[model samples]
Target: MVCVKNLSFRLQKIILNDITLSIEPKGQIIALLGPNGSGKTTLMNVLADLYQKYEGNVHDVGKVQLLPDYAYIPEDLTIRECFNLFGQVYDTFNIEKAIQIFSYLNLNQDQLISSYSKGMKEQLHLAFLLCHDVDTYLLDEPLAAVDPLTRDILIDLIMKFKTNSGVTIISTHLIQDMDKLFDEVIFMSNGKILLHNSVPQLFEKYPGLSLDDIYKEVNRNVPFN
Candidate 1:
């Protein structure tokens, strides 16, 4: 479960202002949506405990892990080495799960991380995070640098976590297929939440429009059909 009330953060200026929301304690996938500099990443960072000097209250139960947009391991280490290192650092890290993910993604564990492409690196980072036993995952741009096949695989893996009551908040600019991935959506602008609703509610309110269209409509502040 994750809850934020009257939260505001600043770094010389306001980044997130007077935001309040609560996420259910069960299986849920939340999409954090907005255009450039809209504070999506800032909100994720706050929830991840990366930034502490903020106003208002933030509360969550169980383990919370963050997957940053640029999360990377030591470049010189092989994939297996990275996993081994993670096991040493985190008691929650599971090698069996890690191996399964690597196999599913068709990643070669013996290869040096430096030799992998950007997409490959993204997959590795996801594998590392998904190997953890956590209640909440704050993933920033999990689909940023991957092909459609890899993206689909990642989505499948994420959805499986729902059965275990894991909550995932994904921040992304790429909204293609979001309708299939997000259980709920939060629209933000200029460091403030514009709207928050379940997918069914959103679709019912804006009939005959995809998520992409709905986002555009919301941003333009136009009446829904």
Candidate 2:
């Protein structure tokens, strides 16, 4: 279980407002639905203790691992070298596991990351992060840089990660395509939670509406300002 209660963050101005959330992981994947600059990154950062000056009580979480908005690997390093470096930093990093993941990408481990394309880098970054065995994964836009075909592959990876008895919160703008895959959906806007509901509950409430339609309806009733 992970809980954030009465959380408010400030950086020049209040970014997270008074937000609260609870997550129960164990083959559970939650969707953090929001648009660009909707406080998704800020909330995840606070949970990761990247920002300490925030007002909040974050509790009951263990082995929290965050995949930040930026890739942490060095551009000049080869894929194998990057894995070795991260393996040294994280005790949970499994070289064997990382190598197995790379088998899918067909990437040359000897080549520098600088030679990879944006989408390739993005996929590699995610693959690297999955090498760590952790309880919580904060994935900001996990599918941001991938093409349609690659997106399916990454989604499969994320699904497999769910069975690891960990909680995964994925922040993404591709809500329509991903909504049905989530156990629950959290609609966030302007630093506030507009709604939180299980996918089934959402369907029950909206009846025949699609996720995009539901989002529109929720936003219409809520004050995004």
Candidate 3:
């Protein structure tokens, strides 16, 4: 479980206001939806321990694995080498499972990361993260550059992880493709949370509205500073 109580951050006098959220330790996927600069990435970074110079408290209740937006896979290293490096960093590294994920994502282990396509690199990064057995996975825009077919594959991979073990927190603007993927949705503006509810609850309250529609409606009226 991850809990943020009155978390706040400031940059150049622009404040990311108090935010409090609690994530349960169950087989659930949470999506953080907001426009660019809406503090989705900032909040994810804080939760991932990438930024510590913020007010309030961030409580990480279990082992956490973070996949940032520009998640770095050394361009000079081969896919296998990258896996080996991550294996050394994490205590529970499963090389066999990594290979399986690579195969599932149609990634070539022998190729250098620089030689791989953007989508393939994303897949490889996800595979590398999955090798570690962590309780929570924070993914930022996992499908940003992925092709349509690969997007489905990546979504399947994420769902498989959630089904097998661990909870996932995905921060992305691709709401249409995420309707069936998320158990809960969190809407944000600037640095403040505007809405947070279960998928079913949201739909029940606003009938005939898609996630994208809700996003547009929320951001249209509420201008983020």
List RMSD in Å for every model shown. 3.0, 1.7, 1.9
Query: What is the C-alpha local distance difference test score of each model?
Result: 0.83, 0.82, 0.80
lDDT string for model 1 (1-225, tens) is 478999999998899989998887567788899887788999988887888999999997468788887756899999899888999999888888888878877778899999988777777777788888888888898888788877887787777543368678889877876569888999988888899899899999999998988999899963222
Q: Which parts of model 1 are misplaced by more than 4 Å?
A: 161-163, 222-225
Model 2: per-residue Cα lDDT at residue 135: 81
- By TM-score, the best candidate is 2
**Which residue pairs does candidate 1 place in steric collision?**
none
**Residue pairs with clashing backbones, model 2:** none
Residues 1-225 of candidate 3 have per-residue lDDT tens digits of: 578899899888645689998877677888899888888888877877888899999886467778887858789998888778878877767788887777777767788889877887787777777766778888899888888888887888887654345578898878888778988989998889988889899888878998788778767889657
Ranking by lDDT: 1, 2, 3
Candidate 1 is scored at a TM of: 0.91
Encode model 2's per-residue lDDT on 91-129: one tens digit a residue.
Answer: 878788888778766779999999988887888878887
Task: Quote each prediction's TM-score.
Answer: 0.91, 0.92, 0.91
The lDDT of model 2 is 0.82
